[model samples]
Target: MNILFVADPLEQFKIYKDTTFSMMREAQRRGHEISACEPRDLGWQTGQPVTGQVRDIRLTGNADVWFTETPRRLAPLHGFDAVVMRKDPPFDAEYIYATHLLGQAEREGAAVVNRPASLREHPEKLAVMEFQQFTAPTLVTRDPAAVRAFHAEHRDIILKPLDGMGGMGIFRVREDGLNLGSITETLNKDGAETIMVQRFVPEIAAGDKRILIIAGEPVPFVLARIPQGSEVRGNLAAGGKGVAQPLSPRNREIAEAVGSALAPRGLLLIGLDVIGDYVTEINVTSPTCFQEITEQTGFDVPAMFVDALEAEVARGN
Candidate 1:
């Protein structure tokens, strides 16, 4: 089987902890051919199949440089057995356009990991709104008065932009409500942008747990990113300390419910972000944590992912 990864530039990857790299390694172990391309490498013409300028990559065991790409050439996406969309987010206009191209490739009979329509339909932050049973008290609004009202009701609240990743632009307005107005202004952009406001879950002191689910099943272990020092964010990108641990019963319950609900939506891989018992986000675009959990708990998260992908590919065929 040949697998084409549509992700960020190969040069920018941190192989030691990168989940996509882990997937590639496991795929190679199974004797599958691996290919690489960025979203920009994809294009479509009237007469051509939705195509990408891709390179066949052979992995060497070198730590600093793990992969060597063969000469790049144009290939239709449908030529590959599976196409993995591993691009990181701020799912802006360009990302949406890239999905449009990938959607075209799907029409050409390629097995794209995340069904492109679901990706467009399920924005991570907004995805939680539908599953209120497992989520924290949350609000989506652009009006300052509404945010102020939510803040007044829940005193300690979190305010964040709709499109931010890695904890950027997230503000915690304490009971005192200091600078609440200003925080709302910055996040909502004075009524022009919509922002999410949720009652702050104090269990954040425990950790922001990332539970990886494959094909609607939960992995037994998770990467709990505990905030360090005075940091309010528990994202690994925001300097949170990652601790791999077995999922609690509550964790599994939430995973079973949420993961099953999303699997048929064309979301093969998902990361459910749990701050305490409440789910904070549902990540479908690029749900990570394979390396962090596997290296510590020996869970073989990437292998599970590849297993799901392989099954999906076979089913598609």
Candidate 2:
């Protein structure tokens, strides 16, 4: 199998922490050839497909790095059995354009996991609102009056950008919190983006659970992300600790509902965040809970993911 990853520059990734690197490593171990290129590498040549520089990728264990040489341009989007869209996000305009290009590749018969159309339609936070019955109170608005009303109603609310990822700009506004004005001003400047105001789930003090779903089935393990002292965000990138945790009945129910809803849409991978019994977020773009879950539970998530990808590729062929 020849696999191509549409992702960030290789130098920016910490080998162990990056799910793309982990998947690439596992794919290589399974005897699949791998290469990678950024979204800018994709373009059409006179209505004919053409791609910018692509380099062969190699990963070694102890060194925690990838080795690549000068890139060579090639025909766009053919010859690869699978293309993994693993770009990290703020999900800006560039990301959407990349999805459009990838969707074209999918039409050409490549097994693009999570389906490009589905990825474009689903922004991580907004997509989960479709399952509001299973989630905490959430409000998407930019009006200061509306946000203030929500804050007054909930008393404890979390404010975050609607399209942000990796827990960026996530804020918890407590009853006595004083910075709402500044926060709102910053988030709303330039008429840039709307913020998500959610009723803060207090169960977060215990931990935030991240459940990984592959091929529409929930992996057996969950990561309980406990925030550091005085921290309100429970994201690993935000100084939270990930401990292996088992799913409770409620967690399983939420996962089952979300899985059943998404599987038919060709979203082969997802990571769902549950704080207490309330589902907080549904991560679709390059979700990553696999490493923490595997490290704690001894589950072979990489192998399972590879198996699912292989199966999808087989079906495409």
Please write out the lDDT profile of model 2 over residues 168-253, one tens digit for every residue: 88887889858987787677662466878899998998888998888888888888899999998889999999888777788888
TM-score, cand. 1: 0.98
List model 1 lDDT by residue over 1-317, tens digit each: 99999999999999999989999999999999999999999999998899999989989989988899889999999999999999999888888999999999999999898989889999999999879999989999888999889988999999999788888998999999999998888878778999999999999998999999999999999889999999999999999999998999999999999988999989999999999999999999988889999999987898899999999988887
Clashing pairs in 2: none
How do all models score by TM-score?
Answer: 0.98, 0.95
Worst 10 residues of 1 by lDDT: 182-191
Whole-model lDDT, model 2: 0.83
Total backbone collisions, model 1: 0
Clashing residue pairs found in predicted model 1:
none
- Those runs of model 2 whose alpha carbons end farther than 4 Å from true positions after fitting are 50-52, 68-71, 190-192
